[model samples]
Target: YKSGQKCVKVIVPENASIDVYGSGWVCNSGFKKSSTSCVPMTPQEIQKQKELEKALAAEIQRRRAQGVSGDDCETEYKTNAEVCVEITGGDLDCNESYGGDYYRDCDATLRYEVSTDYSGGAYLDVDVECSIEIEYKGRETYSTQTDSSSQDESHSLYAHGSDSETMNFNFSFSSYKEITSVKISSAQCEIDSVDLY
Candidate 1:
């Protein structure tokens, strides 16, 4: 029962699924799935994963300092090629409204911005998107700063249904090469001035 609810640690066999509610096994997210058995990621893949974990941990700390719960709870992974974040602790009254029950839920990451570099030449030459779950009230707006007096708004997304929803914004931005500071604002909350290495 504890394992099913993800409330306890239980050993699971190989070639199994952790995302499965009661499949009696658990494993990392990045794996090449075949018809029967599961294949682990290569050495290069493991190194990539470690780097990702460090990046994610840094972001999680920043978000948590902003009073966002679930830094230790909510997580995201791939269901295929899409980035999906896990959502938990919804208002029991609003479960039907959210279309989920028990275990974990996956919300597909929205590719909000995917274009050229921002003006002023200080911004990173890459693309970014809103990877957080918007399950609360108000809206999530995407903006970038090129200069002190100006801001860029490319996308505006709204969170419907529950009010006290918890999620993380993918704020580790810029070129992914040398990110100094990151900031993201949603209708319900704002994570400001997060540091990135």
Candidate 2:
């Protein structure tokens, strides 16, 4: 009885019963009181909690072994490495753009010159075609260097078509070891396609 009220009937909750002295409620055998309710803490629940704690401890140990820790940790091991082998060049000596070897005319003194012209467009696709006459493998063959170049003219309204620039390309044939002589002729550049944006 409280607040000046007289005791009438006792209200007992589930998983709970009257206390030992028969004054108030108490949680039953394996249950615990939580605020206004009784919660079960059976043997199975205790076993599951123990297993979870064991698994958590094992996981923390594994993580700590794998270079992960809170405040007290250090690197487990160290390593030193060195390069054993190194490989180098087969790049073109003349123009890095041009590749492969061809027998050419020695009249140009082993050098080839070409000029490129850009048209009135936002972009220009040009081809620097050169006649290659190289004496390779005891035979003379004539071929054309159809290497291409693309130029951007985005900085201006129209590209200057008259702006001509001559680029020189050198030639050498180290593979063909017969009666030797390589002479690259003068190359010519022409616009393949013009783009305007």
Off by over 4 Å in 2: 1-161, 175-179
Please list the C-alpha lDDT of all candidates, in the order they appear. 0.29, 0.34
Tens digits of lDDT, candidate 2, 1-197: 24356765556789999853455565675665454567776698456545644664675577558763221211112111110110110111121112223332222111112222333334333332222232223234354233322222211113433222323233443434321323222222223222333
For residues 48-103, write the lDDT of model 1, one tens digit per residue.
65674576567657765886443222111211111112122211011111121221
Best by TM-score: 1
Q: What is the lDDT of candidate 2?
A: 0.34
Indicate the residue-level lDDT of 110 in model 1: 20
After superposition of all CA atoms, the RMSD between model 2 and the true structure is 39.8
